[model samples]
Target: MGRDFEAADHSAALIEQVQEAIAARTTLRIRGADTKAALGRPIEGRTLDTRAHRGIVSYDPTELVVTARAGTTLAQLEAALDAAGQMLPCEPPAYGGQATVGGMVAAGLSGARRPWAGAVRDFVLGCRVVTGHGKHLRFGGEVMKNVAGYDVSRLLAGSFGSLGLITEVSLKVLPKPRAALDTALEMPAQDMPCKLRQWRDAGLPITGACHVDGILHLRLEGGEGSIRTAQAVLGGERGDGAFWVALREATLPFFNDRRALWRISAALSAPLAPLPGQALLDWGGAQRWLKTDASVETVREIAERLDGHATCFTAGVADEPFHPLPDGLLRIHRQLKAQLDPHGIFNPGRLYAAI
Candidate 1:
């Protein structure tokens, strides 16, 4: 009963804050640890800290679902999942120790196993949010088959607080793999993509793949027998699992350079024409990270020509860090933003200037 009372009081406080902001026509920057402050266009407003509203609401290993408050740290959630021998399949990055569940979903950043496992949004089942009008609403459910209407829960993923304040999230979890192995092979940067394609077609259990500094690193996770067979077929010396973790966290030497970093998402079989800087390949050639001083137009043009989009992932080089949307998509975004935040008191101009 005391716990329920505390939760009710917290909710009332949050609603009051939102109502005051709305009444005053004051914009608010919803913050959860601020680990991803460097991402997207910068915004300035009254800081609405969600850190104090932290806790794991529920977890059922058998059901493979864990619901937690927005301010709950990723470390806490992962620890609980680990204890249950299950995991967040998306393998989100904890940019810092303060990384929160809300921030993870909002940023929508995935890790090395993304292509094989899934994305952050894929694991999201439902969420509770406070919209601009200070109305508390819940969209989605703990079960996967509860699909009824618009997937507003998943839509909050990667929204970066533009639409509303995500107060809680429900995520689908997966069991840990029975076995895992890491292997590396020396290969030319250009040849790595084709090799990755061949391995993928061969139906090997590849959870992660990256080519950096003239070395191709592959991570395989599954049964022990499959791991041995894949190692034999791939033919590379064993590598450290920490290597992949560093790669995912951007702590590797390859990511140490201070040049402008651009994340390019292209086809798995996309041909590689030598670009003007150091390159690191991940996502089985679908995601490429380039560190270069090249012009924004040059980088984007090359990516567009390859039938992919490039974003200024780390720095403030472009006016829009994300790919520009067409008129049709932009209209949908505007409509949704207006519906959820009619007064536009949420994180305004964080995603796009017009919204």
Candidate 2:
């Protein structure tokens, strides 16, 4: 009864804050730890600090599901999972110790291990959110087989607090791999697509792959025997685990350039085109990060020709950070936003200016 009372008090407090914001017609910045404040378009609004409402709600290692409040820090969640020999398979980036699980899902930024393990959204099972009108709603479920409608939980993953405020979330977890190893080889940027294709076809245990500074780095995670075999097949030189961590968190010297950062998501089979500046290829060649002074039009044109889209991740070179959606898709997004947040009081314009 005492625990239930505390939970009720927490919910009431959050709801009251939202209701007040709605009453004043003031936009609320849905914040969790504030580590990702630099992301997305800047917003002017009263802050809704979620860190005050933090804790793990539940964890069942046998079921491979952990439910926690949105304010829970990523370190806290990862430590708990690490204790059980499990982890969030998506390998979400921890930009800092203050990074929150909500911020991870909200920003929807995946780490080096995305291609093999999955994305942050893929591991998300469900979420409890507060709509702009201050109504509490739950979508999806803790169990894997609980597919109902719309898959709204996953939709909210990359929404960046545009749709609603996520209060709690349940995620699917995986057991940590027994062993991991990194292998590196110097290679040209244009040659990476073909090499990655060959590796993918070879069916090795490559959990992470990135090409930066003429070096193709591959991470293999699995049993010791399999890693040894893979290392022999794809030999270059042994690499340290710290390399991948640096790449994931953008701490490497390659990311320190003073230029616009564009993230291009293209087909692995797409032919590599010459770009203006430094580039780092990740996700087995599907995701490429380019730091260049080139105009957004040039970058988007090249990406579009390759059957992909370019997003201006930082230093706004594009009018919109995300690629412009097709007419039909844009209509759907507006409709969904209207349905969930008719008042337009939740992180307004954080995603698209019109939304």
* TM-scores for candidates 1 onward, in order: 0.95, 0.94
Model 2 lDDT tens row, 110-217: 888887778899999999989976899999899876566688899999999988888889999999999888888899877877777787687678888888889889
Q: Output the lDDT of residue 106, model 2.
A: 87
Cα lDDT, model 1, residue 71: 83
For each candidate, the alpha-carbon lDDT, in order, equals 0.86, 0.83
lDDT tens digits, residue span 142-242, model 1? 99875766799999998999999988899999999999989999999888767877987887899998888889899999999998889889888897798
lDDT of 1 at 191: 84
Clashes of each: 0, 0
For candidate 1, give the lDDT.
0.86
The runs of at least 3 residues in candidate 1 whose Cα sits more than 4 Å from the true structure, single-residue gaps closed, are: 1-9
